[model samples]
Target chain A: MFFVKNIRIGFRRHPLFENLSFAELKPGTMATIIGPNGAGKSTLLRTIAGLHPMLSAAGSANKSGKAHPEQPPIITLGEIAIENLSLQQRVKHIGFVPQVLPQASSLSPYEVIFSSIKSVQPDLNREEADQRIEPVFRKLEMDSLAFEPMHTLSGGQRQIVSVAQILVRRPQLLLLDEPTSALDLRWQLKVFEALQDQVKSTGAVCLMVMHDLNLALRVSDYLIALSAGHLLAEGAPVEVITPAIIRQIYGVIGRIETCSQGRPWVIADETV
Target chain B: MLNPPAKQIAGTSTLTNRHQQVVARRVLCVTSLVVAMLFIFLLDLATGASNISFSQVLSGLLNSSELTTPEAVIIWELRLPYSVTALLVGLALGLAGAEMQTALNNPLASPFTLGLSSAATLGASLALAFNWNDIALTTHLIVPLFAFAFAAGATALILFLARVFDARTGTIILFGISLTFGFNAMVALVQYLSDADTVQQIVFWGMGSLARTSWEKIAIIFMVLVICVPASIIQVWRQTMLRCGEEHAKAAGVDVDRLRRTLMLRVSLLSAIAICFVGEIGFIGLVGPHIGRLLVGEDHRFYLPASALSGAVLMLLASLASKTLVAGAILPVGMVTALVGVPLFVLLIFTYARRQP
Candidate 1:
């Protein structure tokens, strides 16, 4: 369980989020954050992950401006701070998939995955790390690409490997930034399936920044809509995937239709 | 194990194992390459003027010399320590270059690029100008120490400037160039102040040579190398984390700044020791690590040792080349390194730039 309460964050001379507050993340749930570029969606996630530099308000008039409301401690994975944590500590609990996948110089898929685990379990021998990572590789169907240089992998394959690297650590909090952005139709489905399986088995709280509204609808249990760094809506996917919310948050005219299966999907009209 | 046979072969598990094997083999290749480089260094030191055959040189090296004459003195007392000093300095330069490149995440980073050589030159020049020799140790001890201190100070200043100037790699290099000029001006001022003989000596030293090396000085160089080399080696894995980028390293819970500081100080110290005794040996650091990276594929765990050995080989070959290049007068070994390093570096730059995305 994790809670991100009243976490106001901004960049220098630029306001990203102001007095933004949210609370209580339950285990075995996927919360998809959707927003436009430069809306500070990524910045907000980075702030929560404690990866980005801490941005305090610039001479705010309100007394309660900077304080965070008490809630369950959530693991934050901002790209900047992510690089500062020891490999051991990172692997122990937090699994972060950055937006721009990192290039693994000459490291095999196994070395890359093993490093993630090694960060948490430095005492784990190579054999032990391998044993721990094997299942994750299997879940992602990356067995064929395990020995291949990460450089040789196609975009989707590399993304899968990156996901496996994070998943292998069995982190309590899985923070992924556009993990499936590069995946194709079948692979995207498989990736979501893998995430669902992981959530079911580990009860890990997953918070991901997703661009695809349809994919989020299919994969996420909860939805958090953001517009210009402000929270637009937060609720179950069924309650939150409304055309009004999409218009308000994304500034797009959209229609949400519930198929016969009761799964709501939002379709944005380009001509409108 | 009723697994699909294709799955068994093509599975993530097997691929992961294969990557592990690749890493192992890469490490093995790096180690063997290092050994071969060492042999080349031995040959370089051995095959000089008044050539003592390999057997005699080896026996002299092992202290079982029967040729107790001029040849023995020339081999044991003269060429041996000088060759060892060149090797040590080369090794330091390569390690320093690799560390600087990794820390700054810039391929252009080298001892010369960072202005460490100019700093040492400035320090040594200052010592020459003011006669830090007045403090009275043997010329061998005091001169080297003075140069080392100045170089260290210069290194400190450059690192400080890097932080002050916002730590951009390009900015640091530009600042280093400025510092190099500033140090050069200072050296010039020292020369201007010094009498003719003192200026001559300083200028000659600036040209760079391992000719003046002796066993005592080599011992000091050895101690300095011993301290930094293994310390650097121990941090090799962490250095690899850096190749992924500072953000990645930090997220993995590496104290990026701390790693930079440790590596910077160690590299500067080693490099200062190197040039302090050898008077600014050329281009070994600049070229050595790049060559190592090509061989070992940018993994510092292997790259560091590979660079060190490659550097040693480069210097040794340069030393041997200096001897053969002229009939009687051996060219300054620094000149040889530059002549060799420039063309190789051009090739590296062209190839590296072409391969970039």
Candidate 2:
């Protein structure tokens, strides 16, 4: 199981959220964190990914002058604390895809993914590395564009490449911050399907920070809602996403509607 | 849904074939550049003040004892040192530039971007102005020794600042720019205070030349390249990941901050030794990697050696032009490098642009 306990994250002096703990995430499930703007969704994902630092309880002085817990946050995968693991060990277990797209360059997507895997697993020869990479490209259906330079690829295509890079590593826990932000609707669904397949096949836990609440509700096995440094709700999407909770979190009057396939669909009616 | 087994096999084979073809093409490009560099190296060895023919130079190289004393001295002592220094210096700058650009994440970064060349120039200027040769045991070596010391000092300072400031790419670049400007000003002040002959000597050094190289200097530079190039090649995968972006590299488990620091140290060592031995050979560090990137893309496995070979060839050709461009008066190799490299670089860029559909 993946778990975060009493995590507080923010910039140096200002704490965005404190004493935030969530442990409902289990293996072989896709979880999505959804919130309004500045709700610390990405920051939370980054903290779990080890890209951002978790604040000490005695972080910095705040205007309210409230003392937090003295201990640092504990993030664990299975039984091991993430902070206690070495960099190589952490990478082998956790994969993170940041929100930003990669810079344009002469490197092809194939080269980027191949090199990414080789860098982490340097003992793997070319054939072994190629064996790992070809399947990902085929699964993602990016085989034709594999050799094209990154600069020539579209933003959505590059986003897929970024996802593909992390997937090839086959980490036990995947953390992606808005992985589908740049993708079109079809590509976004394809990426979701790919993530689902990965979770089902490998029993990996995938946590993604998503902007589109409707899509998150439609696809995620588990849903987390945050608002103003608070966990507004967390559970199965059908149980967690209600009109009242949506209004409280997003400050918009939203209705929960069921799709033809019996998935929850969020319909924003108007600003509250 | 997956493809059928037969089609999947076919697709895999096609990808393997395409990848092999790409690797083969890059290997061919690097091999051709090495061949060109060798040809220019021979040409450089043959063309000098002494009236040695290409065949004579080859025979002399093959059998040193068969040649007369004067011929041996001319070939072994003078021409051989000059040509080898040019080749090694070219290799150093090109490799340094490629690493620097990747580490700094800036396309325009070169070996001199960190101000090592300017620091060397300042050192040479101070040695010239103060006439340090009078106190030194080896008169001819005083200036280069001073230059090397100052360049190494500057490198240490940069590394120290990088460590203190967390080695952010933007902060390192800003510090490097400041160092370059500060060193250039110091060089100017020393130049202004020096006597006319001292000023002339400093100016010549600033223009740079391979004329003053010796066997010892060539060996020193060769040793440095030997150690640094392989060290760099070992990090080829990490460096290639860096070319994608720092964040990407970091996510791939690379310690970006540590990688930057190590890369800076290697680049500083290569360029410091190179610039100290031969005044300030510009253009090679800046353009060699560009030519290499155009020839073989950013895969550092191919790109690094390609950059080194490109630099070696450019330097050898420039050294040859410096010797033969005028009658009996060899121009400074530094000046010839820009003159020879600019047109060729421009043509390469145009061709690359045209080929990109």
Candidate 3:
């Protein structure tokens, strides 16, 4: 199980989160972070990814890189502190899909898919890596786009390739930011389905920041809500995504309805 | 959740076959470039002023017994060294160019553009101006040591500016231009202060000649290449990772700053090796990797070697042009390359732009 404790993150010389503590993020499940703009959603994801410099106990940031375990900004992924792990060590367990796909990469999708594997698993032969990625490409139905250059692919196709980049690695902790933002409905469903299968089958912890509340509700196992960098709510979808909380955090009058699939989805009616 | 049954993952049979074919094609492309480079090397050796017959050149190579012959002396003392030096320097600059561009995250980054070689030239000019053999250091090592120190200093300055200003690729490139101008001024100032022979020697050094290299210098270049080429190829995975994006590479367990710093040092050393012996050869570092990319996309596996080979090819061809452009009279190889490379550089820019989605 991976757990984050007492994370206080913010921008340069300004505070966003002050001594923010949360419970453990268990394996074999998915959690979505939902908040409005400037709500520290992306910042939080970046902090967890060890990109941001964490605020100290005095509610200030002196250094802006990885956080130490003795401090408040530690993420415990298994036995080791996530911040202390080397990149080579980190990639073995953590696969991160950034919100923005890297631009101007002229590599073919086939090269993109295998690039990380070459670095992360140096022992895996070319044929072995192909065997590992074959099933993922087949499942994603991106087999036809495999040889095409990355710049030639559509945004949605690039997003799928990004997801495939992570999935082929099969990390124990998968962190994504708005992975489906560029995708259409059918591809979104397929992407989420693939993620769901990957999480359940491997007992990995999948965390993502999402704007689509309905899709978030249908797919995620746990929920974490924030507004203006403060924790608004966190629990099962039924308890946390109530209309009252939606009005407080999002400034919208929302309704929670039980769909035919028995999933709790949010439908925003009007501004409060 | 909705989808078809897993017909795609049915068996691993089809994926490997296709993957092997793709890998083979890339290998074939790189292999062909190497062949082309050797062909150019041979063509370069044959077409020079001595009018050594093709049969004599062939016999000189195939028959080791003819080592003392006039043909062997021409090949050994003059043509072979020049051609080998051209090939080696081209390969070094090409590799350095590819690594620098990726590390700096700037398409325009190269030894010449970034003033790296200029910095070295500035240092070499100072050494030449002072006639600094009186220093306690070994006589032969002093010039290169001085050049390397200045080049490293320039790199340090650029990296420091980048960190301080939170500069991205554009800002760093601007700093590179400033360094280039500053170093060129320094070199020019030193030339003005020197006596006539010193000035002439410095000016000739600045023209970038493979013809001046001795076997000793050739061996030094060879040693640097043998050490550097494999050293870089070992980091192909890192280079590929960095190409995708810095943050993305960081997330995958790469220390981006550390990687950049290490590459800066390596590129500094490689460019120092190039300019210390030869002088400020421009444009190859900018255009070489672009040619490599045009031939073999961005796969560092093939891209790096392809770039080095193309670098060698361009140098050989430029050497040929320098020999032929004014008949028996020698034109500066640097001038010839600049004339050839500027147009090729423009073509690559358009090609890169057109390929963008």
Candidate 4:
């Protein structure tokens, strides 16, 4: 299990969070970060994923009431301050699927997947990279798009392909920032299902920032709600995704009904 | 999820394997092109100037009987060095351009764009205005060396600033262009100061030519080219990673500072060696890699070498065309390269850019 401590983070002069505290996220457990727009939910996820560097805990007040180092072993996904690590080393354990799909020139999807492992062993006298990447493409259902240039891919297809690249690396910490935001409803479920399977097979901890409350409630084992860059609540989804917490974090009037699966079903009250 | 898509497909239909096959085929084709280009190079050498027959040229080259005296002298003494020099310069410029494009993550990036050529021009102009060497030595040796040193110095300076300030690729590129124009203005100033005789010599050298080539100059090109080529090959992976950006490259385990410094040094060195002796032979260094990319795609492993071949071939063809343009009069190699390179490059940029968006 990877642990992050005394995590204070921000960019420029403005601090996003002052001494934030979270438990060691482990395999078989998924953390759903929920917050209103501009609430630093993505910032927290990026920090834990090691994309952004940690700020000093001494400078900011913390609800957790603790202080720790400025550096941690977190691998961030999108818009993280990852100036310390190298690409090859980062790919080994930290697979980042940035929010914006990279507009790579002339690189085919197969070549894109192959590049993730080029550092492990360059295709020196052996073309083992292609053999290895085939299964990954098949698993992500991107075999049809494999020959197409990455730039030509549709939004959902590109998202899947990005996730596929990370999955091929089999990173220990999979940090995804709204990976399913742009995906269609079908692809949204499909992408999360793939993530669930990957977590089961590889036992990697997935820290995701998801916008859909119902989806988050279903997929997440634990919930960390933030309001204005401050942690509002942390607990199991049934305890945390409550009407009071939703009103506080999202300012929405919503009913917390139990779904058939015994998870909280957040049905917003339009009359609010 | 989605039934995982039919487990697996047959061998022939899979794109992963097909991509590998395509990469392999492109490599083979590039290798063949290099071989064919070399054959043409040898043929050009044997037939030029004196119009020696293929048989006579072959016999002379093989050290056989019935080989005429003039044929051997032309092949060995004059045409041979000139051909090899053109080839080596082409190789240097082509590979350097490929590396620059990848390093800066801009397709327009080349030694020329980075102002190396202009700086070299300024250096050569300075040397000419002052008559740095008393003897009226061939422009082949003196002109290039001066250009090389100044170009490398300019490159080193830009890299240093980039490192210290942590500037983006765009910033660095703009700085390079500004420096080029600045140097060009200085060259103009030096031209104004020099006498008519000195100005004529400087102008001719700046025009770029293969007319004054000798073995000694060819040896320098050979050594520098040999060193630059393999170094570029070894760094192709790093170069490709750099194309992803510095942060990405750093995260990939590359020491960003070292990679940047090394690439800057190599590009400057190769560029200096390429045009220093040749004066300012324009587009081989700029458009060579671009044409190679269109033919071989963007995998640096193939693109780099293919560019080297294309550069050499284009240079040799341009030089030959310049030679045969008018029986008694010849054109500057730069004039021919600019004539061919500008229109072709403009077409490519528009076509490629349209496909991107």
Candidate 5:
């Protein structure tokens, strides 16, 4: 399970999120955090990944200069406190996919993925490393594109390569920031299906920050909606993505309709 | 459920074969570069003013006791030290340049981007202008000593600033550029204040030459390369990870800041040692890695060694040209480096452009 409790994150003077907490997400569950712009969605994901700083109870004083009585924030994966683990230990269990794509270079996707594995597990021989990487490329359908230089790959292709880089590690908790932002509809569906299969097979938890609510509704097992640093709603996709919550989160008049597969689909008509 | 699809199996086999082919091609490219570098080293040894034949050069190398006195003296005393110095300096600069570019995440960055060469120039300028050779105790060693000290001092300052400010790659690069300009201006001021003879000497030193090297200097540089190259080799995976991006490297548990700092220190040491002796040989550090990348992509295992060999080859070719360009009067090797390197670099770029889709 993965959870964060009373995690206040952002600048010291003006905390973006104060006393914010997330409910427990069990292993094998795929969850999405959906929000409008400036909702601290990416910041929250970064904090959980141990990339961004979270303010402590002692450091987060109110405007009137009194410290809150709350304890320091606690983030745990399974039974271990994430902050207590060393960086090497933390990365073995948690993988973070940042929003930015990999830079264009002469390196091929195969080299990048190979080196990523070798960087952490230097003891693995070339054949052992190849055994780990071959299936990932095959599963992602990127085998043909694996040997091409990164600069020649499309943005969506590069994004897939970035995803493959992390997936090869097989982390227990995968935190992805907008992994499918640059992907087309077909690729997006393929990526979602891949993530679903990965979660099912490995019993890993995936938490993604997603902007496309329809896609989120179609794929996510659970949803958490954030608006202006506040949790608007959190529950099953059908229950949390109602018209009222849409208005509160995006200030738009949205209606949730059932798709052919009986999943909720969100459509926005006008700004509130 | 018992068997996989035939098409899937076929695809897997093809992928494995193609991967093996790619690895084989890279290995062949590196091997070819090593052969070319050895040929150039022999050519450099044979091309001095004494008109030594390639056979004679080989004989002198294989069995020095059989050579005439003058031939032995020329081969053992002058050409050997000069040629070895060029080779080692090239190796050092090439490795330093590759690391600097990766550490800064900028393709245009070279070992000199951190201002080591400019600082060395300022030190040499100061030594020439103030007549530090007049001091009896230091005598012959004053100029190189001063150049080395200033270069090291500049690196120490950059590292100190990086630590104090917790600076990232961009900030570190900015500090290095500022130091380059500052050191260049200081060198110019010293040149303006000096006498014509001193100014001329400084200019000649700045143009760089391997004519003055001794075996002791060669030994120092070789020892440094022996220590630094293996250090770089062990970090090939980490450095290749860095090529993806700093965020990716950090996410993979690499301490990017620490890696950058360590690489900078090694680059500074390598370039400082080379520049203090050779004055300011250019182009090899900047272009060697680019050529290496074109030959064998950025897998540092191949890339690093390829860069080092390419640099040594380039330096040897430049050294040969320096001796032969003006018949009897040897031009500075620095003057010949760009003359030899630019055309080859342009050709490689064109070849790479044609090959890329």
Candidate 6:
């Protein structure tokens, strides 16, 4: 289990959010953060990834308060505090897929996947790295592009390779920001399924920020909706995707219905 | 969850063979560059002050027993040292260029383009203007010391600006151009204020000739190369990672900022040492890595050696052109490099543009 509590993030001299706390997130499940354009979703994900500096806890906050106000803004993964871990140690447990798709690199998919492990485990030989990467590629059905240059691949193909790169590392927490921004419909489904399978097989936790509301409702086990840097709601998809929350967060007159899987499926009707 | 897709279809044989083929091709590409450099080295030795025939050149090189002969004296003392200096300068510049591009994540970064050479020249002028050798250890060391300090200072200034400006490549180049122009004006100012003999000395040094080349000079450059090249190859992983982009490399556990800083300093050191002896030769550093990237791609394992060889070959050819350009007057090697480098640069642009579409 992991907990994000009392987290405060912002740039120099301005605070974006304070007293941000979330309930414990468990392994073998995924949570999606949904918000409008300036809602600080990406900033929160980057904060969790340690890419942004977070402010210290205030003096009056309580340690054990599960409600929003009492605890310090701290991320504890199991027994270890994330901020206290060394960079290499943090990378061993967390895999991050940033919002931007990197420009075409000269490295082949094989090398790109190999680089993560090789950077940490210098003792791994070429044959050993291949042995580790082959299974992840096979699971994703991306073996054809294994030896091809990453620059030569299409956008969807590179996206799949990026996902495979993360899966191969087997990190305990996977934090993704707009992981499927470049993917087509079919590849988007494929990537979400891969993430689900990885979480299932490895018992890892996934936290994602996505713009697509329907996709978030379809894939996420839990949802956290943000509006103007404040947590509007956090619960199961059915609880968080009500018409009132949709209008409040997205400024959309919307409708929601229970799908066959007993989850809320939402579609915007009109701008309020 | 969706079905996990088919298990596996690739053959182990095909995988192993394909991997071996890539290794073989990289080996072949680097070997060809080495062979080409060797050919140019020999060709360079053949044409000089006294025309030594191909047979005489061969005897002088292979059969050193004929040490007192005229051909041997010309070949051993004059042509060989000059050619070696050209080769070393080219190698250093090319390696430095490749590293600068990789570190800065900008293709336009090179000793010439980024005003590193101009800064070196300015530093050398400072040494000459003040007679820094009196306080410094030796004359030979003082010039390089001042050049390296100035070049490093320029690099640090550029990097600092890059951080402030978010590192738009065009902005960085503009900063470099300003530095180049500023340093060039400073160098000219020093010339204007100095006496005629010192001005003559400075002007002659700026011409970038190989006449100052000696066995000792070649050894000094060789020793610098020995120190610089291995220092680079040791960080081969960092070089390759930086090519993937700085933030991405940093997320993957490489310290991208620190890597760029170290590489910038090392490349400046190489460029400073190179220009301190032979003055400023342009374009080899800019174009050599470009040619290597075209031939071997961006994998630093092959790219580094290929760029170094490409540089040596270009310098050797320029040295020959400097000799053959005029009947008796040896043209400045700098002019010959720009003559060769500009067209090649234009061709590279065309190739890159064509590839984009």
lDDT of each: 0.73, 0.86, 0.80, 0.72, 0.86, 0.78
- Of models 1 and 5, which has the larger DockQ? 5
Candidate 5's C-alpha runs over 4 A off are A60-70, B1-12, B133-140
Tens-digit lDDT string for candidate 2 (B1-357): 123233456645666566777789899999999999999999999998879889999998999987999999999888998899999999999999999999998989998888899999998888778775464433358788889899999889988988887767888888888999999999889988888888888899998898778887888898998899789988899899888787778778887777888899999999999989789999999999999999999999999999999999999999999999998988999999999999999999998888677
- Determine which window of 10 residues in candidate 1 chain B has minimal summed lDDT: B1-10
Candidate 2 clashing pairs? none
DockQ score, prediction 1 = 0.32
RMSD after CA superposition, every candidate: 5.2, 3.8, 4.7, 5.4, 3.9, 5.2
| Position B175, candidate 5: lDDT | 93
Off by over 4 Å in 6: A58-73, A139-154, A259-263, B1-17, B53-63, B69-72, B125-146, B159-171, B191-204, B341-357
Query: Which runs of model 4 end up more than 4 angstroms from their true locations?
Result: A11-15, A36-88, A120-128, A227-230, A247-272, B1-12, B64-70, B137-142, B241-261, B340-357
TM-score versus the correct structure, for each prediction: 0.85, 0.94, 0.88, 0.85, 0.94, 0.86
- Weakest 10 consecutive residues of candidate 4 chain B by summed lDDT: B1-10
- DockQ values of all predictions: 0.32, 0.45, 0.47, 0.27, 0.42, 0.33
Q: lDDT tens string, model 5, B1-357?
A: 112133366645655566777899899999999899888888888888887798998988999987899999999999988899999999999989989999999988898888889999998888778775465433247788889999999999999999999998888889999999999999889988888988898899899899758888899899999899889987888899888888878777777878898899999999999989889988899999998998899999999999988999999999988988898888999989999999989999998787655
Candidate 3 vs candidate 5: which has greater DockQ?
A: 3
Compute the lDDT of residue B189 as modeled in candidate 2.
92
Q: What is the CA-based DockQ of model 2?
A: 0.45
- Per-residue lDDT, model 1, residue B190, is 85
Residue lDDT tens for model 4, A1-272: 65554466677487877656676666756778788888777666555544455564444434224534444324233333343454444556676666665445666566655654575356533346666677777767777667666556776776776677667667777777888877888888888887888887887778788778999988888778888767888878888888888888777889988778776677998534
Q: Could you tell which candidate, 1 or 3, scores higher by lDDT?
A: 3
lDDT of 1 at B143: 70
Question: What is the lDDT, from 0 to 100, of the residue A170 in candidate 2?
Answer: 89
Please identify which of the two predictions, 5 or 6, would achieve the higher TM-score against the true structure.
5
Per residue, candidate 2 scores C-alpha lDDT tens digits across A1-272 of: 88887777777676788778876578898998888888888888767766666666644445224545465568888777985565556777888898889878888888898888888888889887877788788889987787778888899999999999888888889999999999998999999988899888998999999878888877899998888878888999888889998888878899888879987788988998
Q: Give the best candidate by DockQ.
A: 3
lDDT of 6 by residue, B1-357 (tens): 012121143454444444556668889999999999999899988887676687778787898775557767788888889899999999999999999888767787787667888888888787777754363343466766777688778878888898887766567778889989999999999999988877876776676778766788789889989998888987787677667666556556676666776787788778877887787787899899998887777778888998988898889999988999888777878668877667766887688667653
Error of 3 at A26 (Å): 3.6
lDDT of 1 by residue, A1-272 (tens): 66664445777677777667665668888889888777887776665554675444334424435533343223343322333344445445677677876565655566566655555466778777777787777777777666555666777887787787667777777878898989899998998788878877888888899988999988998888888767888888778778888777767899988788987778789533
